[model samples]
Structures are given as structure tokens and as C-alpha cells.
Target: MSTTYEFQAETKRMLQLMINSIYTNREIFLRELISNASDAIDKLRFAALTETNLVPEDANYEIFLVPDQKNKALTISDNGIGMTQEELIANIGTIAKSGTKEFIDKLQNHEHLNATELIGQFGVGFYSAFMVADKITLLTKKAGTDLAFKWESTGDGKYNIEPASKESCGTTITLHLKEEHTLDSNNEQNYLNQQTLQTLVKKYSDYIRFPIKMLFDIPVQESDSVETKQELKILNSMAPLWTKNKNDIKPDEYNQLYKHLFLDWQDPLDVIHTRAEGVFEYITLLYIPEHAPYDFYQKEHTTGIKLYSKNVFIMDDCRELLPEYLRFVKGIIDTPDVSLNISREILQQNQTLKKIGKNLEKTILKNLEVMLKNSRDKYLKFFKEFGKAIKHGIYADYSSHEKLRELLLFPSSRSVTEDSLITLAEYVANMKPEQDVIYYATGKDRQAIDSLPQIEVLKEKGLEILYFLDRVDEFAIDMLAEYAGKKFQSISRGQLDLSKFETEQDKASQDKLINENKDLLEAIKNALTEKVDEVRISNRLKSSPVCLISSDSGISISMEQILADVQDSKIKATKILELNPNHEIFKTLKRTFEVDAQSEQFVDYCKLLYGQATLLEGLTVENPVDFAKLIAKLMK
Candidate 1:
């Protein structure tokens, strides 16, 4: 006897939504149905462990894809624990009522069932088939039961169930595909095509523990005649490399897996595998690529990690699994704890994923630290490729600065080679006995920074000066502020305290020289009134005659350069002109001012000195032609 039933009010509304708009891609319908089939098989296996009479010990468990092009029907068949009439009504007739969830709860205390890999969390997955099919027919016979049942639904807010005949225990779902015109008008997927089915199976269900099989026509060449024979081929690999123990897997296998997953030709720089249990169970197989991808810095680039649940692929680029700073990492994260909505395509906002992200960040950082402590060369290689990204993390995430600080590397004045990089800890450890601050200089590169006049005094005192070459370096360090109790100071910015290096007589001479040249300095400052904030005698410029510096409070000169490079940035750094008292040019300036304070020659001398300071600061000399003419006049 057949009985037709009307769906509950809420169920009817949800069924229509699931059929028409719940899933973004119609192709996901197959993934959902296949996941449900896998779950049914898992239930049967788990039940068989306690009840031996449910099925034979040697029963073959698999899911088959059979597509009929002429009839426009696609069938997904699985030999597992099938549902009875009551079970069918409870699981299918009701929306959001998860049979898999109920089964797991019922067997919560059963230790063997805990190991069972069930993929379905929400019963709504079964309804996703309506997206591709005009109607669905399900036939099933529960194991150890003689009676069978058939459930049919057009997804028109109702379904029918009846007792049926079957040879054995299992479940088979046949989808009557929509008409060609209907499919085209609705933009529905055509699953009757064998190639499309195979591709979808490989992409979404390749790691199912049970084999997913499909019949393929094999071409045979026999005695100058070609014929095709049908053969059942396993479509999925069935073994996820990450699911296996690390000790059991070889290094080459991990590299090959990385290459296969990321499509990178080179081996990964590092591989991290972690399994967390107890409160939340999950497994992560992460890879650090040998080099950044071409689109790594582009807005269109997606986060690298893919997310899965119970080895079933969910999303290709799960951004929530990693923070923006670690977007370059590529890997897969699989966990059953995630609360997937009805579609099972996206993650719901929850603390589980966030906690997992925090754990992953710690793991990746620990791996990097190990590489840094034990394998300096390899760590440096990674730093050269990805250090810029890690530095940005310090700027973007203040809480992570202390952890990310040890991973930072910079070139110093004492670095013997072009590639030699020292850490902030190393710089602090090697500080001069009298040094109270960490000194750094910013420029386009090491050579430019080394030539800075302000660095000469620090070098003379045997103090190391870090070279901030990257555009973001200064910004990141500015956020860093202080490291290991030492405040970061830009050598080219503000005044330098070199009193410890100066004798009383040297300080007296500096004071006397500045006192005597006060008029010359004031005259020069007045000549270029708008260009500089102040004119002062410099203790930072040891051998160089002049240089440009920024005030201690405002934006630094390096930051000004960076900001200027950005379009429509009108901000500028406050520039100060500093002159060395011991340099011979200071005497020339003093003599020129004493000879004729209002003379064009003295004004020209001031202009030349300002031009010189500007050039030394890695800035263009404004009015270059006029400055050149002045230089020529001075030569005469």
C-alpha cells in the first residue's frame, strides 16, 4: 500500500529553497548525495561490528554512479544499512532532521562506532538532489529485514512511500533529470553526462574510504580491429595522504602530494602535519611553498588552504582557516567538528574554526622557529622569500609581534656579505656597553643606507645600525616600537646623544664653535626659510659636512618617501639641516658669512649647502640647473 503525505509548513518552505536556491552550484548536488551514501555505508559498518547477523563479514561496500543518457536518469547506488518506512519519513520527510546525527548520538557510547567515518551532519543534504533532478526515486531494504520500501518525491512539498520488493540490503537513488529546455532555462547541471560525473566525483569525493566506482568503455586493439569493452573502474583514490601516519609516509610522497594539491612544480619549503583531539578533533596538512605565487600580493588571490569534513571536500579556498598575514600557506584542514549549514558548502561563524586557526598559527610558527634555531641556512632561504609577509604581520597584528619578532632578519653595518642578515636579538646582544637604544637607518638599499652621513658617528662608536630596505620595514618597526627593552631609534631622525664618546674639551669646542657660527647658521636658515624646520650643529655627522634629518616627533624621512610614492599623498616629513662643526666646509661658511653677510656669494653658499643636504638624504635637489650654475660659480 502506498501513502502520500504533505510536508510540514516549515519543511515545505525549506524544501523549495533547497531545491531552487540553497546551493550556489548545481553540481554540488552530487557531492551531497554521495556524502549521504557514504554515511549510510558507515552506519551499516558500525552496526555490523556489534550485530554480526546484519551483513556478511566479507561484504563489499562501495558507491556506484550509473548515468543513462537516453532516459536522462542518473543513479547513485550504495550497499549499506538502508532505512525502513519510518526511518525514511523521519529522515527525508522532515527538513533539517539529520539521520546521521541521530545515529551518532544513539551510538555515542559505542567505542567502535566512534571510529566510523560518517560525512552527513544535516539531513538536508539529501534534498540537494532536487536541484538537478525533476524527481527522485529511492529504493531500500534494511539489513536482516525481508521487507523493502520505496520513497518518491518531486520536491513539490510532498512525498510518497510504499512497501517494495528488493533482493538484498542497500539503497539506490535514481534522479530523473530535468528536460533539456528546462535545464537550460533554469541553468541546471546535466549530470547524465559520464565525463562530468567522473570529474565531479574526483574533485569532491576522491578521498572517500570506500571506493567510488564508475563503468568506463576501454578501447582495445585486437588483430587490426578496434573494439570497446566496458569495465568497472574505481574513480576515487580512497586514500588521503594526510590521514596516514607521518612515519608511514615517505618524504617524496609528501612532496608529490604538495605538488598535486597546489600544482607547484617545486617541492614545498616545509611541511607541517598536526592532529588535535579531545575537545575538538581535526587534522591539518600544511605546506610552505618554495616561493610565493605570482598573484600572492594581488587582491584577486585567494587564501591557500582548502577545507574538508571527514575527507569530503567542502570549500577550495577557506579564508577563515588562516589570517590574512599567512595567506601564502597552502594546505588542507579536515575536521568533523565544524557546523556546516544545510548546504554543507560554507562554514558557519563559530569559535571552533577560530580556535583551529590559532592552533595552526602556533604550529607554523613553531616549525619556523625550529628551522631558525637548527637550520639557519634553510630558515634564511625561507626568510628571503617570505620575510616581508611575516614583517607585515607584526604591523597588522600587535599581539603577535613578540612571537613574530624572533623570525625577523635585517642587514646591519657589520654584515660582511650582501646576503648576511642579523636578528634584532643578535643586534641587542652585540650592543655597545654604553648604548641605550637600538639604531636603524632606512634607505632604498644597503649601499644607500651605508652612505648616510648620520651613520658615520654610530659606526665610529662600533654600534650596529640595522638597514631598513623594504618599504614596509620602517612602518613595521614603528609599530614594533621597542624590542627586548631597547627602544628603536632612527639614526637619521632627531638628535643623537654622543656625549659618552666626547671628552669635556670636545664638548667645550663644539659649544664654542656653535656659539661662534650662530650668525652663519641663522643666515643660512633665513636663506632657505621654507625648506627646513631648524639649522643646527650636528654631533651625528662625523666626517660629512652636512645632512638632512627629520624631527623626533613627526613622520620620519623614510616614511615620507614611502608615503610620497603612494598616489595623492600630500604628507611630508619635517626636515632639519644639520652641519658638522669640525668639517672644513663649516669654516668656509663662517668665513663667507664674516666677509659679507648680505653678499650673493654667501647666499649662494647657503643654497649649495642646502642642495648638498637634500641630495645626501636620497632626495632630488630642487632647481638643479640653478644649483649647478651656483656650483660652477663657486669653482671660479
Candidate 2:
């Protein structure tokens, strides 16, 4: 007797969506189906670990695909856990109970779910067959069950289940291919005939735990009879690299594995193998590449971490395995606790996956920290390649900012060595007692920051400031406000309070000199109106006559210029000009201003000071050629 079943109203809607809208790429249907077969095989394998009788000694646990051109049908069969009649209806005919209600609600509300993520999470493998087939027939007999059954569906939300006679302990899915699709004449008769499908299987499902074979039809010579057609076969390697123990893997093997996994040519700079046992059990094999991918920063770039459950490949490009900040990292994560039916959306919300992800991040940061401490030269090489990515991590998530700060490196002002980059930890270790904050100044280069009159004063005080030259340096420091209990203070921002180094009398003396040059400062500030926030006698400048500074809230002149070069906006924030009381120009300015605060020479002198400061800070003046002429006039 045939039994008729009406899909739940929600199931009907979800099925329609899956058929028409869920799958943008029809080829994924093959992947989905193959993944399901692999999962079925995995179930039997796991069960065999404890229940030997349940596993057939000669079962040969394999997935086989057979395509018939004459019949226009594709058959994918698996020697694994086949379902009973009731189980078939529950597992295949209906959606899983947990998500059926929500899936229906989403369909009713016209909400869309990513089909790849949905099928991966919901264990809806059978529905994927509809992508390439007008009809699907599933024939199966449960292990240890005598009664076999056939379930037939036209993929229009209706299916029929009836008794069948089969002497096998597995399931066979037959997809009657659409009229337009046919196997080529030159192709082999079996699964080997479809080279493209084999390549896709390798690309997406290579790591499946069970053996996948493609059956091909080829003419065979017989000794006594005429040539006859025989089945030819090929096996897809289902064991992935991450599932193996660290000791069993070689460096070259890992490289080959990563290339296959990510489809990229570059070798990785480092690989991290982590096996966590306490509270959670999982294995993670992560690779840090020597160079970033072409689309590393793009939204469309696939994050390379695959998710697996008990060595069975569940999903590739699983973002839940790592945060977007670590998107450059390529690897695999195998967890036994993760559900086989885990979907992408559910994965984002999975607490266990979140914990695994957190642990993975921790492990990577720890690995980097170790590399920096043990292999300074190697770490520097890594920093040269991935420093920007690390800086990106600092701005990516607040939770990881502190860890990223510890990983950042910069050039020190007092360090004479050009190649050495010091980390915040190193800087903090070398910091002088009574230096309450870590000082940093961002600019185009070290020489520019060194020549700035403001840095001259800091050098005079014998305080070391970090020279940030990379474009990402400023943004990183902005995100990482403090490290090791010391706040990061920008040296070129506002006025410096040197009370820790200079006595009160020295401060008072400097204040007196500033008061005396008030008129000259006012003339300079007025000449550079809106450009200079303020002009004052500089206690910091030791040799240079003047230097530029920004308001406490604004980025430094050098930083502003660097940003302007890359940023689309041509307009930049203004800067303040600070003059040295000890310099000869300030002495001349005082006398020149006393004669006539608005004299043409004094005005020219003010513009010259502002222009010189701008140049020293690595910025172009309104007229570079005019500034050169002004300098020539001044020299003459």
C-alpha cells in the first residue's frame, strides 16, 4: 500500500524557497548530497566503534555515484546507516523538529535564508537533489532490518513512501536528471565520466571521512566472448589534514594540504597546531601565510576555516570557527561536540562554537607572542608581512584589542638601529621610572619626527617616544589607547607638561620668557590665522626654531598629511606653531615685532616660521615653490 503525506504548511514554503531561491549555484547540490552520504557513513563508523555487530565486515563503507545517460538519471548510494520507513519519513519527508517552526515562520514572513548555510545547518540533504532533478527516489533498508522501502518525490512538496525489496544495508538516491542535462559520449559511463563533478567533489568534499567513488563504464576485452562494458572506478580521498595528529604531519605535507584547502599558491609563514582537551575537546590547524590573498580585505573573500564534527567535514569557509579579524588565517577546526546538522546561522549563535572560536583566537595570539619572544628575527619578518593584519585586528573587535596591543611593534626614537621594531612590552620594560605614560608620535618617517622641534625637547628631556611610520600605526594606536597600565600620549598633541623633569623654577623661568615674547607670538598666530591653533614659546625645542603641533583632540600634522594622501578628503585639520625661546629666530622675532607688530618683514618672518614648521613635519605648504623662494630671500 502507498502512503501519502502532506508536508507541513511551513515545509511546503521552505521547500519552494529551497528549490527556487535558496541555491544560487546549482552545482552545490552535488556537494550537499555527497556531504549527506559522508555523514551517513560517519554515523556507521562511530557506531561501529562501540557496536561491532552493527557494522558489516565486508560493508566497505563507501559512497558511489552512477550516472546513466540513456535513463537520464544520477544515482548516489552510500553503504552506511540506512533509515527505516518511519525514520525515512521523519528525516527526509519532514524538516527537523527544532527548526521547522522557525523555517516556516521565515517562509510565511517572506524572509530569506542563505541556502548553503541553511542546508549545512539543517541537515536537509535530500532537498538539494531537486536542484538538478525533476524527480528523486530514495531506496533504503536499515541495518539489521529485513523490510526495504522506497520513497519517491517530485520535489513539489509531495512524496510517496512504499515497500520495496532490497538486499542491502544502505540507501541509494536516484536523481532523474532534467532533459537538457546529459552525460557526454566521450565520457566514461560511471562516475568517472564526469570530470568536473569529480573536481568539485575534491574541492568541497575531499575531506569527507568515507571513501567516495565514481563508477565509470568502459569497454573490456574478454578472452572467449565479445568485448563487454564493465564498471571502472576512482576514489576521492576523504581524510583531511586537520584530523591527523601533529606528529604524523610534515611541513611540506601541511603546505600541500593548505594549498588544496585554500586553493592559494603562497606558502604559509607559520602553522599552529592546537589540541585542546579540558572542558572542550578539539583540534585546530591554522596557517599564517607569507602574503595576504588578493581579496583578503574584501567582503567576498572566503574565510578559510572549515568546520568538522568527529573528523567528518561539515562545512567549509565556516566563519564561526574564527572572527572576521582573523580572516586572513586559513585552517581547519575539528570538534566532536559540534552537531552534524549545524547550519551557518545556528553556528553563529552556537555557544560551543563561540567558545571554540575564542580558544582558537587565544591560541593564535599566544603563538604570535611566543614567536616574538623566541624568534625576534623571524617575528620581524612576520611583522613586515602581517603587521597590517594585526593592526586591523585591533580595530576589529573590542574584546581582542588588549591582546592585539601586546602584539603591536614600533620603532623607538632613541634607538639608533634602523631595522629593530620594539613591541609595547619591550617599550614598557625599558620605560623610565616616573614616566607615567607611553609617548608616541605618528609621522611619515623617523627622520621627520626626529627633526621636529617638539621631539627635540623630548630628546632633550631624555624621554623615548615611539616613531610610528606605517599608515595603520595611527589607527592602531587610536584603538589601543593604553598598554601595561600606561596611557598612550601623542607627543605632538597640545603642550607638554615637563614638571617631572623640569623644576618649578625652570617652569617659571620658561613662563617668563613666554610672557616676554607674547607680542611676537600673537603676530605669528595672527599671520597664520585658522592654521595655527596657538603660537607660544617652546620649552621643548632645543635646536630647531619652530615646530608644528595639533590640538589635543586632532591628529598630528604629519599624521594628517599621511591620512590626506590616502583618504579621499582633500581638507585636513589645522595645526599649531610652537617657537623656541632659545632659538635666534625667536630673538629676532621679539625685536622685529617690537618695532612694528604688523610690519611686512615681521609678517614674512611669521609665514616663514609656519612654513618651515610645516616642512619639518613632512607637509607641503600652500605654495612649495613660493616657500623655496621665501627661503632663498631669507638666506640672501
Candidate 3:
């Protein structure tokens, strides 16, 4: 007996919306169905661990698809754990109404719901078949059960359930392909034929563990006659390349796997295959791309490694496996120890899953260290593309700070070209015997920071200075206050206390310049007032008369600019104005200040000097018009 039942109202709304527009490409329906079939097989495999009889020893488990072009019907069958009559009602007869309602709420909330992401995240992936089919018929019989069921629906808010029979326990899904999805020369994409179906399985489900077989009629050309004969073909790769041993795998095989996973024409930069056993068993196959995707850093771009549990594809791009900073790393991870039946939420919080993530993080960093030491030419090429994002990991991953620091590539005062990068270890090794602090300067780029007044002083002292150009460089290094026992000192942020390196006579001469300029410094500080934190004689300037430096407790100039660029609501830092007492302009200013202590010329000179110093710090002169007038008056 068959009875027509009305669908839960919310299910109908979600189904309608998804069928019409949720999945951008109708062909994704095949991928979703294939994934469901694969999951069913995984569930049964896990169950048989306790019940040996659940899976017959001789029974071969797999997926089979048969397309009837003449009847415009497509059938996809899988011999796995089938659903009981009651289970069918709970799983398919009605999708969880609450899930549908939440989807609607998120839709109205204008979340970033990419159509590709929606196809499988929700429980309604089976309904995606409706995109290419007007009606669907399902036949399923639970394993070790005598009864079978047939569920039919046109997806018009009503479905029919009746007792049915199957030769074996499993599920068979028949789709009545719509007019557009049938055979036609005008239709570029049709699902009613063998060729299109084979292509889709290879494209999306090739990584599926089970052998997906398709049966179709092939034209037999004999010398005397031409006839059609049915033939079976395996449509999917039974064992994905990631499951194999890294030592046994060849370069070409790794490249082929890269193409299969990403569908990219170019090969990967390199591939790392890591398998962890013991407490947390998992396999990580990561590929370094030859080039980044176009929208890799875009706000809406999706990136993460494909996730699998017990050889079953769970989801693509599971962000929980890696920090957001390492979004560029792409590949897959398979963990049999993790449960396949758990929700993505539970998987995220699972202790075993987290342990697998930490192990992967360490392994990736270790792999990078080897590449940098042995294959710098290629590593440098890769760093040129994704080095900034890798540094972002240093600032974000609190637990893996030291490991991330090892992979950083930096430009230094001794660097000749843009690609010349040195590690902190390398920089420290090259440091002057008297130098104990890692001196660095942050700016927009190598050229901009190269011209900084502080850099000139370091150049004169024969000290190496690291150039931090990226916006995130300061934050990442700030988190790591020191590296290899040497503390980081920003040349533009704090005082240059190289007194230990200076000879006693040199120190006395430097102190003499500061004492002689003491009176002028006091007058200049009063003149500038709140515009600067303090006015002092410079020990870190040469050609430039005045230079700006941040207080030791405050932020660097580059950091301040970053906060400003981001439009942060926090208060900005005030700069310390340091005057080069040795410069001719300051010597002339001191003479003029002594002559007329209250003259407007003296005040104009102080403001003009402040404007010049602010410009050197990579900040704009607040009042350009007034500064121009002051300069014009001084020139006259």
C-alpha cells in the first residue's frame, strides 16, 4: 500500500529555493549523490567491526550507475548500509524541519552562502538531484532485513511511500531527467548519457574509495555487422593517490593527484605526504601550488584542505584543520580514528581531531624548514607568492609561534634585490660581534624604508637592520619579542642604545654634542609643545636635520600607519622629535634662536623642522598650506 504525505512546509521552501538557484551548476547533483553513496558504505564498514555478519565476506561493495537514454531515466545504486522503512521516513521522507528553518534564517541574514558550499553542507543535498530531474524514485532495503521500501516524490510538497523489493540490500535512486537534461545536440550539459555521467564521476568523485561502476551499451563493429552489447566500466579511482606511501610515489603521480584534487592545469610546487600513527592516526597530503588562485586573498574566497574520516569524504575545505593564515595550503587529510557520523560542530571540538591538527601544523613547518635549507631557489620562489600569509600565521597561531617563525623570509640592510631573503638565524649569525639586539625598521617597502634617516645611521655604524614591509610584519614580530635569545629592536620605534659598542672617547664626544645643544633643545621643546613627546639631540641621524622616533613603550611608525589605514578607534601615538646637532641647519637654528628667543622666525623654523621630521616618518604634513608658507618665508 502507498500513502501520499505532505512535506513539512519549511522543507518545501528550502527544496524549492535549492532546486532553482542554490547549486550554480546542475551537474553537482551527481557529486552530491555519489558522496551520499560513499558515506553509506563507510557507515556499514564501521558497523561490521562489531557484527561480522553485517557484511558478507564474498559480497563486493561498490556504486553502479545505469542510464536509460530512450526512457529518459538515470539510475544510481550503491550496495552499502541501506535504510529501513522508518529510517527512510526520518532521513528522506522529511528533512529535519529545524535545519531548513535555520537555513532560511541564514539566507535572510545575507550570510556568505556560496552556492557550491550549500550543495552538501545541509541535509538537503539529495534534493539537489531535483535540479536536473522532475521526479525521483528511491528503492532501499536495510541489510539483514527481509523488507524493502520504495519512496517516490515529484518534490511538489508531497511524496508516496510503498513496500518494494530489491535483489540485494542497498539503495537505488532513479531520476526522471527533465527535457533539458535529456539527449539533445543543443544541450551542452545533459545527464541522460554515459559520457557526461562518466566525466562528472571522474571530475568530482574520482577520489571516492569504492569502485563506482557504470553499465552502458557500446557499438560493436564487426567486419560483417554492427551491433550493440552491454559493457561494464569502472568510473572512479578505487584508491586515491593520497593513501599511498610517499617513498613509493613518483613525482608524476603526485602531480597527477594535484590536478585531480584542484583541477588545475599546472603542476604543484611540491607535495608533502605525512602519516601519523599511534595515539592520533591520520594522513596529510599537502600540495604547494605553482601559483595562487585569482581570488585566493579575496574576502569571499574559499580555502581549506578536504577532510575525510575512515576513507569517506566528509567535506571540502574544512577551515578548522588549519588557522586562517595558512588558508593557501591545499590538500586532503584522512583519519580513520575520527567518527564519520558526527556533526561538523562535534568534529571541530573533538580532542583527537585537534591533536591531528597540531601534528599537521608541526609537520608542515618542518617540511618548510627542509625546503628552505636544501631547495632555497624554489622555496624563495614560493615565498615570493605566499610568504606574507605564512607570516600571518606567526601572529595568529599562539601555540606554533616558534615553528612559524622558522619559515619567515625577510629583507635586510645587506640584501641586494627584492628576492634576497634571510632568516632570523641567518641574520643573527651575520650580526656584528658587539651587536646583541636584532635591529629592524618597518615601512611600505624596501625602497621607502631604505631612505629612512634611522637606516642611514645604522648603515654608518655597520649594523644589519631587518626591513619589515608587510602590514602584518610588526604584529607578527611583536608577538615574538625576541628570536634565538636576541631581542628585536625597531630602529624607528625606540632609542638606539649602541653605547656598549661605542668607544669611551666616541661616547664622550656624543655626550658633548647633547650637552652643547641642551639650551636649544629646551627652547625647541617649548616651541613644539604638545606636537611631540620630547625634543632631543639625535644620536641616530646623519644627513637629515630632524628625525621622528616612537617611544619605547609606544607603537612603531609603520604600526601606527597600519592602525590608521585600518581606521582603528584607538588613540594615536605621539612622536619623539630628535634633532641632528651636527647638521648645518640645526647649528644655524641654534645661532638664530640665541639671537632672538621670541622671534616668529625662530617659531617658524621649529614648525618647519617638525613638518620635515613627520614626513620622514612616512606621515603626511597635517597642514600642507601652512608648512609651504613657513618654508616660503624662510627662503625669503
Candidate 4:
């Protein structure tokens, strides 16, 4: 006897939303149905572990699909835990218990939703079958129960459940494909053809935990007779890569598996397979690619890892497995503890997964550290591609800043001896006993920072300053305030208090020169009102006449320019001009200013000094073309 049931208001709304909207692509129906089948098999397996008699001796755990063009029916059967009459009504006939209300509400609001996005949230994936079929009929029998039941729905707010006769201890879902969806032209039949359905099954359900099989026509030759058609079987590979042992898998096998999973042609630079078995049991296969993908920096890019529960595919591109900063990593993480029907909202509350994620992040960072030590060349190559990401990590968290700082590499001034990039540890090792700080300067290139007049002062004090050419280097150093008890200092900022390296006589001579340039410095400072914060004679310059420096608390001019260019903000800080006392131009200026302190030529000389200082320090002059004319007039 068949009993028709009307859906609840929310259920009716959800059914309409799902049928008319929820799934953007109709082909996802196959994945949803196959996922339901896999879950059934998993339930059966779990039940059999405790109740042995419930499983049949010859019951092979597999899903089979039969396409009947003659009857217009596509039947998908799975030897898994089947539903009873009550379960059929509860699971299929009504969506009252399913969380589809929330899903429908979200979809109605035009929120982003995908098939996998709603999988664990609501146990109503069976409804996805309606996207492709006009009618769905489910024949099921509980494993130990003799009675069977049939649940049928037309995806129009009503369903029917009835007693049925079946000998199998599983479920069979037959989808009557709509007329437009039917593979054949015959109006009498209601199903997809064998070839079309098999292609759909393979494309969408290839990764289902349980074996998915389809019967195909193949040529067979009997003794003295040629048979044109015979039944042949195909089983999609359903064992996920993370389920395998690390030692049992080869490098090529892992690479090929990644290629198959992501359809990415480039090989991964490294693969980390780890199995954890303590408070939480999990298997993870993480991969680091040789180069970042085009969408690596995009906020919409998938997180690149699939999350699984109990060897069954749960979700693809599970963002909970990694933080946003580490989204470039690609891999699969399988944990039996995760709920099979977990929702995106539930993932946020999953403390165990959060802990697992934190541990996995630490493991990856430690592994990278090991690689950096053991394989320097390979690590350098990796840094060349992903080093900016590492720096980004340093800037992301304060707790991991020290560790990320140690992982950073920079060109050293002393590395003039070699082209090798030095780490913070190496920089600390080479630091002079009295030198209590690590100095670094950032610019467009190593040669640019090396040739800057600011470095001459640090070199005169016998300090080894690191040359930072990469844009990330400045941000990274800022995040890494200090290393190994030494503070990091930017040498282009303010006056260098080199009291540790100066003798009494050197200090006396510096004081004498400062006194002599006091009048000329004051005049120069007055000539450039808003430009120069202060004017002073430098004991640091050897070849260059002058250089520009920012305040001690301020960022360097180079860093300022970088920030300005990146953010497109107006330059807010002015620079101090420090003139060389021994240079000819400075001495001539001192003599001229001493004779006629407010003369026009003296003012022109001060402007030239300020413009030259800006030029020497890698900054643009206020007016480049006017500055050029001034230099020409001065030459004449």
C-alpha cells in the first residue's frame, strides 16, 4: 500500500530551492547520490564490526549502476545499510529533521553555496537526484530485516513511501530521467543511456569511498565464432591517497596521484606523508608545489586540500585544514574522528580539527626548516619561489615570528666574499663582540643599497649591514624586531650613535668639525625650510658630499617610498641633510657661508647640497628639471 506525504512548509521551500536553484550544475546530482551510497556502505561496515550476523557471507561491498534504455530507468544499487519503511519516510519522504531549512534560507538570500558546502550540514543529499531526474524511486531493505520498502518522489513538494518486495539487503535508487534529460528519443522510457550515465558517474563519483561499477559492451571471440557484444565491468579507484602508508608509496606514485587529484601538470617540489595516532588519529599527505599557481593570491582560490572522515570523501578544498596564509599548500587530510555529516558552521566549533590544524602547521614548518638545513640548494630554490610566503607568515603571527625570522635569508655585506645568502643565525655568528644590534638596509637592489652614502658610515664603524633588495625583506625585519638578544636596526634612520666603536680622539675631531660647520649648517637649514629636518656635518662620508636621513623613530626614505608607491599615499616625512666636512664642496660652502652667510650664491649652494643629498640617498629631487638647470648654472 502506498501512502503519500506532504512536505512541511520549510521542506517544501527547500525542495523547490534545491530543484530550482541550490545546485548550479545539474551533473553534481551524480556526486550527491554516489556520496549517499558510500555513506550507506560505511554505515554497514561500522555496524558489521559490532554485529557480525547482520552482514551476509557473500555480500560484496560495492555499488553497481545499471542503465535500462528499454525501461527508461537508471538503477544504482549499493550493498550497504538500507532503510526500513520508517527510515524511508523519515529520510526521504520528509525533510523536517534535515537542516535543509537553513540551506534554503541561505540560498534564498543569494549566499554562496555548493553541493559539498551543504553535504554535512544537512543529511538531505538524496534530493539532489531531482536536479537531473523527473522522478526518483528508492528500493531498500535493512540488512537484518526481511521487509523491504520503496520511497518515491517527484521533487514537487510531495513524496510516497510504501511496502515493497525485495530479496537484497541494501538500497537501489532508480532515477527516471526527465524527457529533456533522457539519452534516447523514445518517450516510453525514463532513464539515461549506459554510456552517458557511466561518463557522468566517472566524472562526478570517481573518488567515492566505495567501489563504483558499470557494465559495458565489449567484443568477445568464442571458439570459431566472433561475439560483437559482451558484459565488461569497470571499477573507479576509490581508495584515497592518504589512506596508504607513506613507506609503501613511491615518489612517482605520489606525484601521479597529486596530478590526478588536482589535474595540475607541474610536479610538486615536496610531499609530506604523516600519520598521527594519539589523542586524534589522522593521515595527511601534504604537497608543496615548485611554483605558485596564478590563483594562489586570489581570495577565491580553493584551499587545495580535501577533508575525509573514516576513509570516505567528506569535503573538497576544506579551508579548516589550513589557515588562509598557508592556502597555497595542496594535500588531503583524513581523520576518522570528523563527523561524516559535518557542516561549515560545525567546522568552526570543531576543537579537535583546530588542534589538528595547528599541529599540522607546526609539522610543515618544522619539515621546511629541516629541508632548509639538509638540502641548502633545494631549499634556496624553494625560497626563490615561496620565500615571500614565508615572510608573509612572519608578518601574520607574532608567536611564530622568531622561527620565521630564522628561516629568512638575506645578502650580507661581508658576503662580498661569496654570493651565498646568510640566515639570521649566520648574521649573529659574525657580529662583533661590542655590536649589540643587527643592521640592515633595504633598496631596489643589493648594489643600490651598497652604494648608498648611508652605508659608508656603518662601514666606517666596521659594522656589517645586511643588504635587503626584496620588498618582503623590510616587512619581515619589521616583524622580527630582535634576534638572539640583538635588536634589528635600520641604518638609514637618524644619527648613528657609534659610541661603542669610537675612540676619544675620534669623538674630539668629530666635535671640532661639527662646531666649524655650525654656522653654514644653520644657514643651509634655513634655506630649505620644510625639506631638511636638520643640517649637520658628517664624519661618516668618505667620497660623497652629502646624504639624507630620516628621524630615528621614522622609516627610511627608501621604505617610505616603498610604502607610498604600494599604498599610493602622499609622502609625509621630511629628511635631514648631513654634509661631508672634508669634501671640497662642503669646505668651499663653509668658507663662502663664513664670508657671506646670506648671499644668493650661498643659498644656491645650500639648495644644491639638499638636492645632491636627496640624489645620493636614492630619492627624487623636488623638481628634477630645475635641479638639472641649477647644476648647469653652478658649473658655469
* TM-score of model 1 (CA atoms): 0.66
- For model 2, residues 484-577, the per-residue Cα lDDT tens digits are 7888887777767777888889989987987777766777888878777788777667888888777767566656666676775565555778
Tell me, by TM-score, which candidate is best: 3
lDDT string for model 3 (451-552, tens) is 888778788889999989888888999988899899999888768897977799979998998888788888888899888888887778888898888888
Question: Could you give me the TM-score of model 3 versus the true structure?
Answer: 0.70
Q: Which stretches of candidate 1 lie over 4 Å from their true place?
A: 1-231, 342-348
Report the error of model 4 at residue 245, Å. 1.0
Q: How much lDDT does candidate 4 score?
A: 0.76
| lDDT of model number 2 | 0.75
lDDT of 4 by residue, 1-636 (tens): 999988777877877776676454465566667777877887786677557899865667889888776666778888899988878766776666534566677668863466544542344667767766878898999998899988888888888888899987889999887665675444222236556656666555555666788877676888998777847566566767567777877677687666445545457888999999989999899888877754565555677787767776566767776766677788889898887656657876798888999889888888889988999987877777777778788877777785577788887887754347888899999888999989988778777888888688778767888888777677777777788889887777767777788899989999998886677788899999988788887755778898888777666677678879889868665578888777898879878888898888998898888888787777788899999999899899
Which residue pairs collide, candidate 2? 121-342, 121-343, 189-217, 190-215, 190-216, 190-217, 191-215, 457-540
Cα error, residue 239 of model 4, in Å, equals 1.3
lDDT of each: 0.80, 0.75, 0.80, 0.76
Worst 10 residues of 2 by lDDT: 184-193
For model 2, the superposed segments whose C-alpha errors exceed 4 Å read: 1-237, 277-281, 298-300, 503-508, 562-574, 624-636
* lDDT score for residue 562 of model 2: 64
Candidate 1 per-residue C-alpha lDDT over 9-99 given as tens digits, one digit per residue, 9 for 90 to 100: 6667655654544333566567777877877887777667557889987999999999876677889999989988888887788654324
